[model samples]
Target chain A: MSVNTTPMPPERLLQLDDVHVHFSMREGLVRAVNGVSYHVDRGEVLGIVGESGSGKSVTARAIMRLLSKNAIEAGGRIRFRPEPGKEVEISSLPRDGRQVRELRGGHIGMIFQEPMTALSPVHSIGTQIMRTVMLHRRVGKEAARARAIELLERVQLPKPTEMIERYPHQLSGGMRQRAMIALALSCDPALLIADEPTTALDVTTEAQILELLKSLQAEMGMAIVFITHNFGVVADIADRVAVMYLGRIAETGSVDDIFYQPKHPYTRALLQSIPRLGQAPVRRLKTIPGMVPDPFNAPAGCAFHPRCAYAVPGRCDTLVPEVSLFPGDQSARCHLAGELPEEAL
Target chain B: MVGYITKRALWAIPTLVFVSFISFVIIQLPPGDYITAYAAQLRHGGEYLTEAQEAAMRQQYGLNDPILVQYWRWISNILFRGDFGHSLEWNAPVSSLIWERLGLTLAISTLSMVFTWIIAIPVGVYAATRQYSLFDYLFTVFGFLGKGIPDFLLALILMWLGFTWLNMDVGGLLSPRYESAPWTFDKVLNLLSHLWIPVVVLATGGAAGLIRVMRANMLDEMGKPYVETAYAQGLSERQVVWGYPVRVALNPFISTVGWALPALFSGDVITAVVLNLPTTGPLLLQALKMQDMYLAGSFILILSVFTVVGTLVSDVLLAWSDPRIRYA
Candidate 1:
């Protein structure tokens, strides 16, 4: 079959079409990513916001094909645009094949949550960074070394030449993360995946890392799928946001639309939970009532209905909600999407 | 590193002295001297030992000396003259007696160690990578059986099979022709042909235990985030498994090498006896049985030295291999 020859505009760099990831455990099948669909445009920072067990990280790993041994891609596709009008179905690629291998740290790169454990303790930072460079590029040792140093400099790690030879343990958490980012950007990937990259750092270090990522994205014009639980972080860095709840996308819109005009009851509760600056001192901050249901025996119908205060009693608890598209490229998964107020904040 | 090694070597001196002293004390714990056992053997042969002969024996061996004086004499001879004393059982110098059989024992033990590691490493890597698979479960079962069955019993079974089914003589480390022959190429080849019997007998239990240890270590290393990190780096599965987790897994395995070395030389006494191999194990056992204090004590001391040196070598190797274990 001939490929599409038309000079089509590149709208979205990566798209997940109703992807479902399940983990087969001794207890039961865990619905990790249940028909979650979203698209990340070129140079767009798509923030995936969710609490623990909300399947945001799993979704990121699915795109990267870095899920654990137990995980199963039960359904749907992760279609990545290689170039304008050209797409590759990541879900169809073998987990350990050359295609996925090239996709990882080549066309797409990932930086994990814990910088301390993300880099191998035995190898020097330069060697680890050079691994990506050597893997994706056809360069000799000397050239790869030069590129490694250049990447380190790009990540703004102090004394790139000297720091390249140093091990991960020698560097501070912030510096280690900088090195990790250098490793991720070594191949100049079209898309970057940051899975809670700053979760393990101090608040100050987290801000610095966020600043570095923003600058790098702007400099390279690369799309980023940033997974985090912090709404503040999404507000600061994200252009578009996808709010997930119980393995499904509850809402996807512009950051302002989700934060200021949250249609889903769950998103509104999450926004309420964050303590705003200059707010009155209170004994307790707002929290969604119930926990993420046990995945083995997840609640039926609308997963958030149990915890949602504005849940339609019989309707929300009994019937599963469908995606409702609004006028401004915003969508929500709720039965009362039309009836609910546009601005809850 | 040189300073650290020197410190370790210096520390070993007192430790070996204490170990030798303990062996001396323990050897003396048994009732009566070697003469008493000799005299009893004579009685069993229908020849009574008279009071005159008993007195003569006591005077000849300096049995009248105090325990501390005897110990001092023994230790002094070892320290100053480099003599390990005369063996009452063989009536030969301890050093010469050990030296006669040392080569054969070393060859067998070393070969067994090589075999154990060669087989165990790959099997361990396989079992760990294919964890919970049919192959892993089968190896696990075999591992337990190998560990549980006594080495002597296995030796006996192997001997029976070699003799009855294979129609082979599976005793000793040399053929009849090579037993008295010089160390020529043909003699060495003959020795090699017979060497496998004892080596296989010894390595069965060792390789099984080692395989289990290596598999456990690999599993642990595989679970670490570093392994996943390598995978995320776009490394091939082989590269990720061997180059990353297996390298780290080797630390614990290398540390066990010290204990393994001494065990090869001194351990598996029952297996040695059953196979009738001309190694130190049978000699040590006989010395202890006949209350040959000097010979038994020397054997214990040598084994202790092997233990110490083995541990030291493994420690240095571990420090060299694992960056996490840097010595001050």
Candidate 2:
């Protein structure tokens, strides 16, 4: 490994390698994240786009080793390199162990969809943020308080001093989200996992929160795994995009490559379905046909075969397609991704 | 907050008046007055009262007065002078009989109430966090059984069990040896030895109810985003479970405990009788049965006040615990 020769290949903070997360159910097993694999480099934003149950959030929780008790992430390695030379295998650590606790909120932080529910109603915003600061850092109460107020101000929440004394219910939705973001960033984690954080806000508030997050990411110089279903959100903030369908990566590439040159049929169908701003009006927005197959009774091979317009019947219906690699860390889990002529669709 | 409390306290006045009137009327509605029962008792004791003598006795006792006038006198004495009138059967002041047993009743109720929470909260929290585990299922079954069994029946069974297996005296607030003895360390020990049975009997049903309530409450709160948020902050599972969900689950529990305040005087009356405990519950039952109007009325009135006051206290505690409540 001639590592010293080539500008040290921008260090990878987190790399999820062929991870599989399944949940045990009374009826059967739910394969939430099936052979999912991706990575985040230092100070970069990786957008994970998917439907509600497509396992984007599950993947984020897998990286944090915070899956629910019935869930098992036993199949693959979630390697995290928080520092330059050190590596911690997150998937191997016990979900509720002391080691995971030290890793969470210190090396990685997460914010959720609904800020009102995510923030505790009983504790003041300051107490919530300050506790995170104090948990990871050896700081006195006053110092933690100072850091909390600073973080609150950094998120641009008005009235930092007054807001610190206010509970989550006292704030507006945007304000609560800002406070949550402040809490997540309290310990200065190297990576932040924001899982549809703007989904619950009004359009203006969502825009505000996204803008705030973009600015904060720029200022802190930390990697972000932003999970969202909104294509607009992905286009606004993502450097690289991973489009997921039925718990598998459909296509992953640079933002331009995903929007302009989608290789997988699922990704192409998703792009055609959205209502773009300048496009001519149509009778109806194109929606991908067929329901997402139930997790308990997933189809035999390609989970998306029933819905893929370009599915090769025998190939996609029986043999699961391996991820075909491409240039520039891009790939697609479809049998025909690399065939140049099929990219026209 | 002070103003809010003051407003609630003021509302209790008319409520007390209404309660007094209703309880007074209900006590009077029974087939006969206390004197009628007293006359029957005298007849059974081989003392004959002529009709004229009975009339003279009723007039002398002011029983012939209008019911409203009698009610006025009773309520006036209680309000202005703290006089609960007289107990016709006991030939003593109503206050004296009530006071003698009320102190003991309050102590027992408070202890059993504390016991219920101490046992229920942790057990409920544990069952919820370990949802479908062995202890969760066990407590769920135990909770159902405790709720289904009648308090008096449980008391009888426990009494028998204590005597047969433990060879322990299971009845009354004290042993026969310590019944009339002055307060001493040995007497205190004897009292405590007997105290546990009543406490356990009284606590069983309440503890069962609270455990189920707390368990359901914790289950609801545990899955709320805030608990996950706490864990996402890298908190240990213990800290995450105890810090937010447990605290939220206590809202209903504190209210239940507050409602138990009125149970101080009259909870599980039959159980008290079965155990032969010297508490207010049994005394109240006897008073009601004998149509001891003053004594019965006083007991009901006091219990009503306790209930209203208990609700007020619960509201205040809830506000203190949940910041969102202050706005509401």
Candidate 3:
């Protein structure tokens, strides 16, 4: 028998640089996404982690140009190098223009958080999946149906043939999520933006979905932007992690570095807040004190300064910390990050 | 689904009968009596009829019976023999007279409904999609104006325009020339020319109301997450709004179709009189005014049946369209 061989590593896919998305409200301009930058290599899973209102979702929405009318992209660019020779600036693409339409589903597919609301209740799942497949691929109905059934199987949904005929309401939450995944993968997109794909799922289902996504990435060599507030999920699936604090990227590193040696005060505080099984129950868990500042009226210098435990009096409050690269393949935005006293190892 | 329709149809019989009985009682309980009105007219026109003869006429027409008995007899006649009794004033069978007028009214109502849906759906979808734009504002203003003006006033305006400017006759279903013309293409055109005004008057307010409802529903459906999901799927904007949202939003509009039919049909009394259109609405109004109990009561009963049937048909249609809706 001839020897089997592995496929070549896929190329570097998406690079976002200094991306800033703002929303204009009555109070002021809310900087929903501020200077967020990350790159996804082919088949790499990049996780963006933060609490609610930290701009993780906004960053994803900005990438997709799915933000509301009031939202403004103030700065930076999203560059997509589709193949070896082709590259395009995603940020410059008009929202409703033909190029953006071609990019969506054809190049960059997205899976939203809530599967119940994401699938149209009126249409059957087969019709919904067939629509995207036929529209993007110019495939005939018979071939699209075969592809949709294949996708349903790839996402690990049971009874693929029968499930395709059912409505969204007929499926369970986990199954609906899987169906959404199948829809996203219908076009065989290069970059898959999963915005809290597993957030609404139960713990067991979440673990299964994560495994399925990991396996699919291995098979297809698709880059993924996995946005979530759950650090545990990031720890489980992400090759690299980006921590967002009030729209800005507070820290960026490999998963191991960010979890064990988080340098930014906000990142450290976020990790501490995850209740461990061995930790004793307390009256209140180790929550970072104070709420995230209103994005419309974000602080002048460090947005997280008010809530930071190790905040320097004037340094943290008045001067914006530059994102500085550290020694161990990590970067952080904090005035005294490198100079902090080392804890006993 | 067949079982559901059967159950609904079975339930509708009692409801229709109850409505007919109530309509009969309410129309009869009013001040004037059909026999009295007929006798007074005869006396005024120099006809010699004795009081005994009038009493005999009342007995012959079953007017001497108690209110409940008369209602029972009327309902029984309709149920068993399909008889609506004879008109005291016109001396014609109620069924034939009512049927003639009912056909005209129904034709106008059907045409108006067709026009209303054709205009309203597209305008509504456009308005909702282009919300806050100049076209939306202009259509919204027109919608409000159409709804604000009464149907009769609209008819009066059309009459004035047609009579003074175009020198068009403002009466009947067609010109006198076409009344004797053979059933040909030219006669159909003549009939349609006379049919235009009443259809427009009846349909304009309905179209305006439907557009408002359709616009609101379309807007609400557009904001739903599924719509955004459609867009995110790389489907065209047209597909997102029309393909998905329109079908979902149409449930409410479909259900409203039944109620709109009867209202549009029977609600045209004033408009009918203003245009001198010999439709059921004006006929029913004349019947009531002359206290021709059999004619008026039969017309009321027919109107009630139409209302009930309209609602039932809509409910069944909605259930058929949406699996989520059940008719238990």
Report the lDDT tens digits of candidate 3 across residue range B1-328.
Answer: 7888888899998998789878888777767677677777788989866889878988898888888898888778888998998898788999888777777777887888899889889999999999989999988998999899998899888878988998987667788888778889987887887888888987888889888998999998888878877888877788788888998889998887788767755757888888788788888888888778788877777778878999999989987876556422
User: On residues A174-282, what C-alpha lDDT tens digit does candidate 1 reach at each position?
Assistant: 9999999998888888899899999999999999999999999989999999999999999999999999998999999998888778888988889888898876787
DockQ per candidate: 0.52, 0.79, 0.64
DockQ of structure 3: 0.64
Write candidate 2's Cα lDDT for A95-177 as tens digits. Answer: 78988899899889999999989999889999999888999997999999999999999999988988899999989999999
Candidates 2 and 3 compared by DockQ, better number = 2
| lDDT tens digits by residue: candidate 1, B66-185 | 877777777888889889977867878988988887777777888888988888888999999999999999989988898999888888888888889988767877777677887899
Give the higher-DockQ candidate: 1 or 3.
3
| Native contacts recovered by model 1 | 0.44
TM-score of each: 0.90, 0.93, 0.90
The candidate that wins on TM-score is 2
RMSD over all Cα atoms, model 3: 5.2
Q: Which pairs clash (backbone N, Cα, C closer than 3 Å) in model 1? A: none
Reference-based lDDT, residue B161, model 1: 88
- The CAPRI quality class of candidate 3 comes to medium
TM-score of chain A of 2: 0.95
Query: What's the CA error at residue B306 for candidate 3, in Å?
Result: 1.8
**Better DockQ candidate (1, 2):** 2
